[model samples]
Structures are given as structure tokens and as C-alpha cells.
Target: MTTSLTIAQAAEATGLSVHTLRYYERIGLLDPVERRDNRHRRYTQEDLNWIDFLKKLKATGLPVRAMLHYAELRREGNTLESVIERKAMLQAHTLCVQHTLAELQENLAVLQRKLVLYDELEQAARAAGARAPRNSAPTPPTPERMAP
Candidate 1:
């Protein structure tokens, strides 16, 4: 027989706070957890895996409601249409996040270059025993040219 985990054990295994576990149960994110006769929640290995998967889903930035909907579909068992729809939604979200990350990375590179230039200018002025004058600034890198 597979060993069952108590709520506390599940929480520890899943790295989720006990309150969050309860809250997940309260919401539709999780199915009704099985309970012992005395009213203690008993989690199976499948439950643990599901919680881990849920954490990954939450980490991916899916809204709670959307996640709940996905969970509901999953609970209804594997359906071709539901699977395809879920995959499409996840793929779209992944692409959006990837694009956002690329943009942010480009911006960061531009800023880093500007900082480096400023550092060089400051060092030069300090060596010359004077502050850098605020006249004719260097050409700034364009957003388009910041790839890498």
C-alpha cells in the first residue's frame, strides 16, 4: 500500500504553507482532499505530484481563476478538446512571457552600456582633478540595437 501523507506532511513535501494548502482547498484550485475517519486529511502520492504541478503552474503566472478552470477541466478527466485548449493557452502565455523577458533583457543591456560609459567618463574626470562638464553628451544606444 502507498503511504498516505497528512496535511502537515503534504505541506512540508510541497513547500507550501499549511494555510496556503487550506486556502487552495477552500478555492476550487484543489479537489476535495480525502480524509480519515477522524477527519484528518490524507494525501496520496498523486496528490503530492498534483500539488507540485500546481506550484509550477502558479509560478508560470497563471491567474488563480484561470488555474482553477484548468484544474476543473483536469478533474473532469482527459478530454481532447480540453487538452488542446489548455496547451494553446499555456503556449500563448509562454510566448508572451518570453517576448517580455527579451525586451527587458535588451533594456538592461542598454542601461548597462550607458552605466559603463558614465563610469569611464567619471574616472577620466577624476584623474584630471575636475568634474565632468555637462555639455555635448555621448550618443545613446537605440532600443533596436540592444540585442545582446
Candidate 2:
């Protein structure tokens, strides 16, 4: 028999707050949850799996509207058209994520180069027998100055 968890248990297992889970259902990001006779939600393992997938999408910075659209498509069942659309959406999102990662790497390289420059400057000053004051470190470059 499939095990079921209460709403509180589902929230703890998914690392999402109960309020967020309710909000997700209300906003149509999630399908209506099953309920016990007392009207309390009873989440199945399938629901937990879906929630995990949702979390993955959220981690990828997929906007809520896009996620909602994906959920709608998903609920339409695995028809060929829905499958194609989902694949297309994921491909576009993947490209966007790749671009963002590239930009972050470039920014990280700049910061690393700046640190190296500071180290070289400090070493040269020490070699010249001058004690650079703690407050003598150069100010961080502004965006205008950061341009190559």
C-alpha cells in the first residue's frame, strides 16, 4: 500500500513552508491535494515527487508564471504536443541559465584578477621598505572603471 503523509509532514519533507504549499495549490502551480475525512490534506509519495521537481525548477530560477504554465501542460497528460512544448520550454530555460552562468564566471574572473593585483601591490610596497597603512588600500573600482 502507498504511504501518505499529512500536510505538515509533506512540508517538512519538501523543505517548504505549509503556507507556501497552500499558496502553490491556490495559484494552480499544484493540483488539488487529497484530503482525509476530517478535511486535512494527505500527500502521497507522488505528490512529494512532483514537489521535488517543482523545487528543481525553482532552483533554476524559472519564473512562477512559466512554472504554472508547465504545471498546466503537465496536468493535460503526456500527450505528444504537451511533451514537445515542455521540451521547448526547458531548452529555452537551459540557454538562459547557461548565459547567466557565463556572466557570473566572467565577473568572478574580474574579482580574482583584482585580488591578485592587490597582492602584487602589497608585496612591492613591502619590498620598498614602506609599511602601507591599513587604510591605504585602493577603493573598489566603479562600474565605469571596470570596463576593459
Candidate 3:
């Protein structure tokens, strides 16, 4: 027998609110969920797996419209053309994520360089028996002045 969870259990397990799960269903991101005799939704393991994949896509900054498009493509069944289209979508999204990651890394390097400069300034002040201003921080070097 396949293990199934109620909507509440599915929400808890997926770390999504019950309302969000219902919204996903209503928005066509999720297929209409199976229902029990009492009309409560019963989420299968397959449902949980799909939800997990959706969360991953969201975390990677895939826009909701894109995610919905992917979901629509997925529902078309696994024909060769559908597979090719899905692969193309994922490839394009991967490039977008890579670009964002590169930008973030560049920004992080700037912050690290600024921290190093602050540390050097503090040491210089201490060596010269000077006290840093109580309420003001030293202006950080401009990007042009910062060491490459």
C-alpha cells in the first residue's frame, strides 16, 4: 500500500503553509490532489516529491510564471518534444542562476576587501594611540580606490 498524508501533514512535511499548498493547487502548479471519501485531500509520496522540486526551483529564484510554465509543460506527459522543451527551459534557467551567482560573488569580494581595510585602519589607530570616533565610522574606500 502507498503511504499517503492528509493536507496538514503534507504542509508540515514540506514546510509550506496549508494555504500555500491550496494556492499551488488552485494555480495549476499542482495537479488537483487526490481526495478522501470525506473530501479531504490526500497527498501521495509523488505529490510530496513534486512539491520538494518546486521548492528547489523557488529557492533558485525561478519566477512564479516560469515555474508555472514548467508545470504546464510537465503535465503534457513525457513525449520526446516535451522532454526537449523542458531541457531547454532548465538550461536557460541554469544560465540565469549562474549569472546571479557570479554577481553575488563579486559583491561578496568587495565586502571582504572592505573588512580588511577596516581592520588595517583600526590597527593603525591603535598603534598611534588614537581613539576612533564614538559615533562615526570612517568612510570606506571607493571601489576605484580599493585594491583589485
Poorest lDDT segment (10 consecutive residues) of candidate 3 = 132-141
Per-candidate Cα lDDT values, in order, are 0.86, 0.94, 0.95
- Which parts of model 1 are misplaced by more than 4 Å? 130-148
Writing each residue's lDDT as its tens digit, candidate 1 over 10-122 gives 99999998899889989978888999999999989998888998887788677788889888888777689888877887898788778878998999999899999989998
Q: How close is candidate 2 to the true structure, as a TM-score?
A: 0.84
Tally clashing residue pairs in candidate 2. Answer: 0
RMSD of 2: 5.0
Candidate 1 matches the true fold with a TM-score of 0.75
After superposition on all C-alphas, the RMSD of every candidate to the true structure, in Å, is 7.9, 5.0, 5.9
Tell me the spans in candidate 3 whose CA falls farther than 4 Å from its real position: 132-148
Ranking by TM-score: 3, 2, 1
Model 2 per-residue lDDT tens digits across residues 68-146: 9999999999999999999999999999999989999999999899999988998999899988678877787899998
What is the lDDT, from 0 to 100, of the residue 17 in candidate 3? 97
